[model samples]
Target: MSEHRQLPAAPPLPDPPPRPKKRQPTQDEITKARLKFLKEMSKHYITNEENIVAKEMFRLHKYNWPQILVVTAGCEGESDFVTFSSDEVLRVDREFNYQCVLARDRVGRIISIPLDFDIKCRVVSHDKASEKQFIANIIESHSLPVTVKFAVPDNHIFDLGESAHRADSFGCMALLKVYDETYLISNPLIDGVLDPHIIIIPLYLEMLISTVVGAEAMSVKEWEEYTEEVKKDAAKLDFSSVKGRKAMAIYPDIPDEAQDTDIYSYIRPDSYVILREKETGRIPKERINYCEIYKCDKDENVYEEITPSVPPRAPQKKPCSSKSAGPPIPKRDKSSTSTKLPPARSDVSDLTVAELGEKLKLLKLDKYVKKFEKEGIDGSILVEMDQLILKKEFHFKEFEAIKLTKFVQSGHIPS
Candidate 1:
């Protein structure tokens, strides 16, 4: 017989309702959220400061404790201000390690979280004998201290037009030479002067834009064209637009000439440009802000409502061990014995960034290596140093490859 009649078709399933789309936040809402976050951060910072002061009072007796002061000086004729106060400023001495941490990381929540900008200063009892002992102990222990002093310039000074142009693109800029002086050039330069003493953290794009606009005026169209030409000149480079969201998309195109050169030619790639402000002579002092920062031990004791603070002293040494010390290991000489330690690794001081990068790539360590190798470092030293400095100084999350590629294209390395 014929197959049984097909079962009644299953009832049609209800069409799934379309998912509701989430509404995007309005600009005002976004701004309000950011402001709220900043306020919360301010509260946290205040709490941290209070806790630090309390601990300092407990650790150092009121009579012998260190005092910290933070000051900011405005341009000439403007009043100086205390931006922030802290007694435990040196408690975060470990934060100094953050400098190395930041070099390798993308902008993180730490930077996004606003903080009160304050310069930290400490008063120390400058005893030559005590200070000498302290420094010697730190050096012997290979520890970086929080209480070193350097002579800063009597006052911060800058050429108005030049400083303004330097800051025009970045809202603020600083020039710190090998000597201790640091010149700060700040926002909205009028007649080439910083109008205020407040340390304003410029917006991110503001910095980039400042860098771009401060340079010679070139149309966006011109930039695109120039980029195209640069790509053509760097034959080894392939053109590609940076992926994902960014304020600006960097188009990497290598020209033909650049391609023929070895990839290790550039150690420090130049990512931004600077242009001199056209000026016949220096602007008058009236147009610029000149200020000076005093040299202060960041870990000295000073008068405070809380207990006094003591200078960081050397660790007291323990008495000599009662048990006999182990016998010293004799040094080996290859001339007299067949067994010899492996030859010392090559010094990395002379290796260019590109060359080190190539070795890193060969070793499949590119993921950990950065593109900005010291121009004089040696590749062997990198492997020998166990890539400590490289890992600490140059690791980039998303842009590691980009930085390496850019370095190759820049051709700034020695032959």
Candidate 2:
């Protein structure tokens, strides 16, 4: 019995044959998995009304060629109905369904179609027919009991150019507002369609508008911040003024004669601030070289080495009067002015939120104390605050922004 022993424990059972290594998935398999997940998610989010509409539309036009009437507006505010075949609409819907899945996944919530997509239809009423009539016709023709309304909430229309520029990079999609919920639909036609539009129906005159079109593909908090920013921008009188405006320069050196002309200042990659005329499209060479040029930094420290071609002129001294002036005043040398920036204070950048609030109070900007504290802005963020951020993000007035900017740039926080 003792001789039977262990027999070397049966050679460890050959390690269970390595379990076949669980085969790594290929890229194609991974893509298919992702698409399957997106498809399931999109199906889960699609409303019953949308499904009914799709089914009825397809059924009604099964024998006859289907045509979708899309209400569109041109740049001149002129409106018309653009017709699309059933095949085209279905193709666009397929693409839009894919986009909705991606947007929902990225945003972690159901959102309207992103503004990156072309406009499909509008919720506004046309001269020929109102949204109510349109929905009434569809309901009567299909004999379906679906209700909708056109009184869209939050009458805020986003700036098309800005919204498109800020919207996340994604494929094209359309918009549809059924009853109170707005969804992304698909349409491929670019012409005759407004850049950003929504479709709605009128039953109770109450509707939910899609506010996610212009969103920057951020978190919920970020989206709220962005919407507030858009509202503030829309409310401001200078919103249109800032559009299409940019800092640009045609020449390295700007002449004195061009000083009176409207000019824009730009920060160079090397930290030098260069001045250029506002209209830099085409300018005469004579206007550009009319005077000596110089550059400056963010601290307004002027550097004269920008134009080496121009010779330095000697400063002219006025002749002294014969009569003795009561104690001759000392002349200040402009060349001797300090080019160094103010020293940074460690305490200013290390201040807590409470201390930052106190500093704001000292600066007579206590009104923003609540906002700062709510946003958890401490000394580190305070040090980085600028006029644009204060105005755009915090909704500060022009004077308030200027004052805050000065306070931050001074680097001297009061105790």
Q: Which candidate tops TM-score?
A: 2
TM-score for candidate 2, residues paired by index:
0.19
For residues 358-397, what per-residue lDDT tens digits would candidate 1 score against the true structure? 7556533444444335344444443333222333445432
Model 2 C-alpha lDDT versus the unseen true structure: 0.31
Model 2: residues with Cα > 4 Å off, grouped in runs: 1-344, 411-415
Model 1 error, position 287 (Å): 4.4
Best by lDDT: 2
How much lDDT does candidate 1 score?
A: 0.24
User: After superposition on all CA atoms, what RMSD does each candidate show versus the true structure?
Assistant: 28.0, 29.1
Per-candidate TM vs. native? 0.17, 0.19
